[model samples]
Target: MSNQTSYDVVVVGAGNAALCAAISACEEGAKVLVLEKGPEHKRGGNSFFTDGAIRVAYHNLKDIRKVVPDLTDEDAAAVVMPDYHEDDYYEDIMRVTKGESQPELAKQLVNRSFETLVWMKGHGVKFELNYENQSYEKDGKRQFWGGLPVKTENKGIGLMEQLFTRAQELGIDIWYEAAAVELMKKEENICGVAVEQDGKRMTVETTGVILACGSLEANKTFRSEQLGDEWEAAIVRGTEYNTGDGISMATAIGAEKFGEYSGCHSIGTDYNAPKVGDFNKPGDIYKKHSYPLSIMLNKDGKRFVDEGADFRNYTYAKYGREILKQPDHVAYQIYDSQVRPLLRKEYDLEEATYYKGESLLELVNQLPVDKQQFLKTIEEYNDAVQGGEYNPTEKDGKKTTGLTPEKTNWALKIENGPFYAYPVTCGITFSFGGLHVNSSGEVLKKDNKPLSGLFAAGEMVGGIFYHNYPGGSGLMSGAVYGKLAGSAAARYVLGNKKDTKITN
Candidate 1:
C-alpha cells in the first residue's frame, strides 16, 4: 500500500499553535492533518508545561468576561483589576526585549491578542482568572499584578485537552508519534511533508504546511550552538521532542531565520526535577518562580541575582541563566515564615527540594553550602532591607539599601521565624530564535518575500521574544499567529480570497 494521502493543510507539531492552526483551517473548509512528534501523553510542546496564563490585552472586567463568560460578578467586584490595554501590552514586549523585537510582529501580536483569545473561546477553549499564578489576597481584595490576570481552565494541560477535544470535534485528523522530518517542495512551493511514524518513514502530500514544532532547547548540540557554551548543561523544561525539527526543515527550504538565537525562556526549577518535564505534574508545577519573594543564594552562600529586582513574571525567565552560571549550576531560594504563606502553591509540592529551620544557621547547615558564608549573606541581606511597608501584590518599593545588587522591590526582612529554602537549577522552556514569518503567517525567504505554501506559528515562528520573556505571553503569541497562519494557509490551498478572513 502506498503511504500517501492528500490534505489542504499539514500542521507539524500538536501543541497549542498546531491545534489552533488545524482547527482554524478546518473551520475554513480545508482538510487538515496534524502530525505530532511526541506520543499522545507528551503532546502540547512547551505549552503543556506552562501555567497557561496567557498575556493578552484586556480593557477591564467586561473584556475578561468576554473570554470567561462564567466569571461571577462577585468575583469581579472583589478584585483590584488593572486594564492591560493594547499600548501596555506592546510596551511590555518592547520593554522586556529592550525594543529588540520586530516592531511589525509585536504590533500584530498585541493588536490581535484579545480577538484571537476570544476566537479560541469560541472554539471551546475556556478561560478563568489565573488565581494561583497571578493573584494575591490583599486587604480583603484579590489584587492581580503583572498585567497577566487570566489563564486557561485547568492550566496548561487543560488548555491542550480542550484544544485537542475541539480539534477532534471538528473532524481534524491528528497522528501521534508522527514527526515531520522534511518538507517536500516543488519549485520553491511546499507540496508535502516527510514524517516518521512508528519508526517508519512516510510522505503525505499537502498544499500548505504549518511548522509549529517549537524550538531547539531540547537538542544539546543546538542548545550550545545557538544559545551559549553552557546551555547544553541546562535542563529541558518542556518536551525532549522539540529538537529544532521545524526550524531545521523550514530553513532547509530557504526560510529566513530571525530573532535572538542566543536567548530563550529559562526558569528556576527544582534541582532534582527530571531532565524533561513530568507529565503528572504539568503546567509549571516543577518551576520555582517565587524566587522573587525570596533571596537566591549560591553554593558559596552568596547572593547572586537580585531576587526582587522585579515581579516574578518579569525576572523569572532570565534568572535561571544566572543560576545555571552559578557554582554547580545550582542555587537555593531562601525565605522565612513571614513570606511562607505568600509563596505560590508550587513550593508545597512533595517534589520540591525544600528545607526549613527555625534559625537561619540551622537551615544553612541542612543544605550543601558554605555555612559561614550563608549565615553572613543572610545577616547582610536582612540588615540591608530598608524599613518599608511590604506589599506582595505591587512594586511596593520596599528596597534593600547598600547591597551589592539591591532587592529593588518586595524587600522584607527574613527574620520572622522558621526559614524555608529550595534548591533550583536552570530549566529552559523554549528557544527565542526561529523562522521569520509575516503578519499573514507566511514564512519569509532570504529576500524577505513570503515563501509559497509555507506557514508557521508558536515557538517555531519567533521574533516576539528576546533576551528575556514576560511570563504568559508565549501562549498568547501562539494563538494570535496560529490563527493567522491557518487562515493564510487555507486561503493559499483553496485559492479563495473572498470566502476567508485573510487580507492582502
Candidate 2:
C-alpha cells in the first residue's frame, strides 16, 4: 500500500467505470487513488464477465474507423455496416425502458457514447468489429444488426487489462482488498473515505469521492427485500464482491434512491452454472442468448414468452424474469437441426447442460417436462409456422399463425431430426435501482440537490435504465458518465483548494 494518505480524488471500485474516473482525474492533474473490494485476482468486478460489446451511434465504416483504426481496406469491404444516428440510439433506450428513462441522463448517454469510446481508445483501450455476435453472413457479406458493431479485442478480460495498464501508466494508485465502508464527511461537504484494508480500518483524505462500486445484485438480502423473494433464487452472473457497498454507504449519508427497484438486467444462463460467477470461466460463457431462434418451454411444457418478439438484443434481459416465474424456475430452449447452424457459440460449450435426441419424442423423454404436452406444443407450433425467407440479420416477418404467445418473427418449424434442448435459469447481472445522479454525474440528495464532493458512475448511477436495457449500452453508459464524473470531480476539487485541507 502507498504510504501517502492524501489524494485529490478517491474512486471506489476497480472496474471499467472506476478506472476511467481514475485516469481522467489523473489527466486533470489530480492525485487519484482507486479501491478494489476484491483481492487482486478478482479485480474487474462485473465488467470482467461481459463480452465487451459497446453500443454507440455511427454513420458508417468511416465513423467506425475513428475507434477501430486498424481496419484494412479488404476487411472493411467484407462487411455491410449501417448508419445508427443519435436519435436512433436515444429511441432504443426509451423503447426498451418504455419511456421511463430519465430524459437528461438518456440524452447525455446517447450523445456522449461515441466520443467516450474515442477517448477510451486514446487511453489504450482496443476495439474491433463484433462480427461474431452482432452480424450474420448474407449474400457473401457480413451484415451487422442491432446497432452494435464494436467490441473490445479479447472481450471483458482484455478491456480490464488495458484499463489497468493505462491507469498504471498514468500513475494512479490502486489498492486491492481495500473496500470503502463509510463516506467521511465534514459537515455538509465530503472530505475522505473510511476503508477496510487487509482487515484493518484506515482513512484516506480526499476532496472528491466517486462511488463506482456497483449495486446490490449480489446481496441476497437486498435482492429479496428490494426485488422480491423470488430474486433470492436468482444466480449471480458477475462479481460477488459488489454486495451493495456503494448504495448503502451513499444512502447512509442522505443520497436519494432512484430508478426501478423491482427491475434488473437478468438473462437466461446455463442451469448448471455456479451460484456465483467463476473467475476461472468468465466472459459471458454462461449466457444462452440465441433463444430468439428457439422455443423456450417451461416445466408445464408450454411457451411462456414470444421467443422472437424482437431481436435477442432487445428481449434477452427481460426474458429471464419470465423464466424465474416458471414452475421450477427453469426453462428449456428447444431447437431442431434446421436452425442448428444459427445458435451462438455458448450453446456448444462443454459445460452446457443440454439434451440431444434424434427425434422429438426422444428429446421430450430426456427432459423433466410433461412428455405429452411437450410433443403437442411442438406439433401446434410446427403447423403455425408461416413460410418466408428466414433472415437472421433483420426482423423477418416469418411468424406463427395463431399461437397463444405468438412467435412474432424467425418462427421455424421443429420438424427436423437431431434436436437439442438446453436448460436455463435466471442469472441476475446487475440491479437497475441505485443512487440518483444529474447529467454531470453528481450524486443527488433527497431534496434533488447535489451532494458535495460525491459523484457516481457505472451501475451505481441509476435513472439511465429501467425494466430492460439495450444489448451493449451498459458499458457505454459507464464510460460516458465515468469520464464526466472524473472531470467534474477534478474541477470541483481544484477550484475549492482554498477551503480544502488534507490531514494525514
Candidate 3:
C-alpha cells in the first residue's frame, strides 16, 4: 500500500453515494480517498444490490434525452412517457411520508434530481429507460407509469462498475477492506478517520470527511432494539456491510439523531430468501413487488391489508411491516392466470417459493394457510370485485366493496384457472433514522449547528424519509445529497485557494 496518509477529503464507503462524493470532490481539484469496509469483490454497498431505478422530474421526452441520449425516434415512438414535474416528485415524497419529511431536504431532493442525474451521466454513468420494471404495453404503446422511468443500463452492477471506472480514471485512491472504525476529531472539527485495514489500525488525515456508509438494517440487534422485536425476523435485502458504522461513529461524536427510528423501507420478499442479502442474486430478486396486482393472505387466510390501496410504489415499503405483524410473519400473494402475466420477474425466479394449481381451491389447499378460510376469503374477494376497465398501467378505480379491507384499485377477480400463490415475509431494506443534515449536506450537532469538517450522504443522512418512501427516491436522494456533500466538503478544504463554485 502507498504511504500516502493525507487527502483533501476522505469518504467512507464505496457505494454510489460515496463514489459520487469522491468524484465530486475530485472535480473540485481535491485529493479524495475512499474507504470501503467490504472486500474488492463486495465493493459497492446497498447500491450494487438495487434495481438502479432512480426517480427524477422531467418535462417531456426532450428532458429524458438529456440523460438517455441513445433514445432514437423509433424508441421514443414506441413508448408513451409522461412528464413528472418537480411538484409531482415533491408531492409524492410528502404524501408517502405523511408530510413527516423535512421540508428543506425534500425540496432539495426533488428539485435537484434531474440535474444530478445529468451530472451522473457526465461522469460516465450510463442511463436507460426502466422498461422492464416501470413500463406496460397498453394500446400498442408502452406506457411508463410511476413517475420513475430511468435506471442505470444494467441496473446496480452496471452503475457501480461505471462509477468505479470513472473514479479510477480520475486517480482517486480507493482502499477496500478498510473499515472506518472511528471519526478522528481535532477540538470539535473533524480532522481524520481511524480505519482498520487488513487487521491493522491506521489514521488517515483529511480536511473533511464524508460518511456514506449506509444504515443499520443488517444488524439484528440494532433492528430489534430500534424497530421492535418483530423486526428481528426481517430479512436484510441489501449489503451485509451496512451495519450502522456511519450512524454509530457519528452519533458517538455528538451528531444529532434524526428521522423515524421505528420506520424502515421494508417489503414482501420470498419466504425462502436468505437471512441477509445474497450478492450472487442481487438486484432485488428476492422482493415480490407485484402485490398491487395480487391479494395478500395471512396465516389465518384473511386479507389484512388492501393490496391495491394505491400504487405499489407508494405502499410496498410499509407493507412488509404489515406482513411481519401476521402470525409466523408469513403471507401469501395470490394471483389468477389472468393477472399472472402482470407479475414482476421476481416471481418466476428459481429461488421463489410458490405453489400453483389449476384452480383457486386447489391452489389454496396447497398453501400453508387455513385451506377453508382461504377459499372463503377468495370467494368473498371475487364477489366484491367491481366491474370496470381493468388497467394495470394506472390506478383504474375497479375496486371491491363490502370487504373489511377493500382492494381499491386493480381489483380483478381470481376466477381464471392456473392460480398461483407465492409465500413471502418481511424484507428490510434500510433504516430511516440517521444523522441530521442541512441543505448543504453538512451534518448537524445536537444543538442544530453544522458540525465542521463532517458531512453525510446516502442513507447515512436522514430526515428525507419517514414512515414510507416513494420507490426510486432513495437512490435519487442519495445522488442529490451525495453531490451536495462532496461539493461542500471540497469547498471546505479549498477555503480561499480557488473558486470552487458548483453548477449543475
Candidate 4:
C-alpha cells in the first residue's frame, strides 16, 4: 500500500527543539507531523547530550532568591545575573558575532526570555531551583559553582519526553526513521518536505515547515568549510546524526549562514573525561578528581591554561591557540590516586589508563618524562603558593592569578602517595555554527527578508553568536527560539505582520 501524510505544520528532527516545535504546533490545534531520522524514538540527536539548563528572565534562580529568606535583591541578582540578561549578555553576543548577530532579533529573545521560562513551567519541564534543601557540592564534585545555595537538575531529556507526549496526545503524527532528504517548495515558498519512510520516499505537505535537524558537528565537510581545516580532523565524541541536514536543505534554498563558533570544547578522550555526566559542574567533572598541579603541558609539555579555570572553557581557548602552533595539537593531564575514585563516582571515569604508585616519584617513573623538569615545575608551584606570589594569567579580567596550595581546597599536599595521570584532549560539544535567523526565529536570506514559510531554532540555526559562547546561552537560545519560531510561524499562518526578527 502507498503511504502518505499531510499536516498544517511539519516539524523535522527529534532533538529538544524539534520536540518543542511539534508539541507547540499540535497544542495550537494544528495538524503536526514530526520526522525523526533516528530510530526507536531515542533522544540522542543533540538535545540528549545537553545539560538542559533553561535560562529565562522570570522564576530564574534570581527570582526565587528574591522570595527566599534573608537574601538581598542585589546579592541574588548578582549571583544569577552573571548567568544572563539583556544588556551585558547582548553585548557579549554581538561582540563575538562582530555585530553580525542581528541586534533587533536579540532584543526580542532577551525581552521574552523570562516569558519563555514561564511558558515551559506552565508546561512541565522541571529545573533545579530551590531544591529539596540539599547541601552544596564543592571541590567540583556534582555541584554548581563554588557553593551557591542554588539547586540544579539535568533532566533535559525528561523535558523533551514531556513535550513529545503532549504532541502525541494532541494527535500529532511522529515518523521515526523518516529522514527528510529534501525541502518541497511551491513557487517561492516551502510547502512541504520529502522524507524517507521505511526505505520508501514519501511527501509530507504543509502550509508551514520548521527545520530543527541540528548542526554539522559530525559532518567533516561542513565543519571544515565553516571552521577551517583544523576542526576537520578534530575528534567528535558526541552525536553523529548532526550531519548539517538543516544547513544543507536551507542552503539549497538560498539561506544565509552565520555563527562560526565551532570551538567551544571540553576533555572527552576517556572515562575520566566522560562528556555525559555531572554536567552541572563547571568542567567535565575531571578536574576535581584529586588532580595535582602537574604544570598543564601542551604537546611539548609546556603550561598553557591556568589549570584552574573550568576545563571546558580551558580546552576551547587552549585548543584554539595550541592546535595551530603544534603538529598534534594535544595536551596531558597529570594527577594521582585521589582523582581516580572521585572521577569514577562523578562520571564513567574508567575510560582512562590510571596508575596508583607508591609515591609521586614512582608515578613519574612509569611515564617517560624529564624527571628533573617535572620536579622543578612542582617546586615552582609550591613556592608561589607558599609565598603567596600571585601568578596571574590576566591582570585585568578574570585570570588564574595564583593557584596557591595553602589557599585552595583541591590543594592537598602532593608530597604524599598513589599518584595518577591521564592523557586529555578536547571533546567537541555543541557546534555553534548554524543557519542565519533573526532573533524572532525567522530564517533570513542574504537580502535580509524572512524566508517565506520557513523558521529555525536550536543549534541547527546560527548567526546570533560568532566565535565565543557564554555559559548556558546556547541552551537558553533554543527554548527562546522555539517559542519565537512557533508563535511567529503561527502568525504567518494566520496572516499577520511578521514581528521584527531582532534580538538583544
Q: How far is candidate 1 from the true structure (C-alpha RMSD, Å)?
A: 2.7
Cα-based TM-score, every candidate? 0.97, 0.98, 0.97, 0.76
Number of the top TM-score candidate: 2
Which is the winner by TM-score between candidate 1 and candidate 3? 3
Model 4, residue 50: distance off in Å is 2.3
Better of 2 and 4 by TM-score: 2
* lDDT-better candidate, 3 vs 4: 3
Whole-model alpha-carbon lDDT for candidate 1:
0.88
* lDDT string, candidate 3, 1-504, tens digits: 457999899999999999999999999889999999988998899999899999999999899989999999899999999899999999999999999999999999999999999999999999999998899998888999999889998889999999999999999999988999999888988888999988899999886999999999989899899999999888888899999989999998889989998899999999999888777887888889999999999989899999988888899999999999999999999988999988888788788888999977778777777889989999999999999999988999999999999999999999998999999999998999999999989999989998889999999878989999999998998899889999999998888334445521
Per-candidate total of colliding backbone pairs: 0, 0, 0, 22
lDDT of each: 0.88, 0.93, 0.91, 0.56
> What tens-digit string does per-residue lDDT give for candidate 1 at 247-267?
999888899998889899898
lDDT score, candidate 1, position 197:
82
User: Which residue window of length 10 is worst by lDDT in model 3?
Assistant: 495-504
Whole-model lDDT, model 2: 0.93
Candidate 2, residues 1-504, lDDT tens digits: the string is 798999999999988899988888888888999999899999998999999999998877899999999998898999899899999999999999999999999999999999999999999999999988999998898999999999998899999999999999988999989989999889999989998987799999997999998889999999999999999899999999989999999999999999998899999999999999899898889899999999999988899999999998999989999999998799999999999888888888898889999999999999999999999999999999999988889999899999899998999999888999999999999999989999999999989999999999999988989999999999998889999999999999987884545431
Q: What is the lDDT of residue 199 in candidate 4?
A: 80
Rank candidates, TM-score, best first.
2, 3, 1, 4
Candidate 2 displacement at residue 320 in angstroms: 0.8
Report residue 189 deviation for candidate 1 (angstroms).
Answer: 1.0
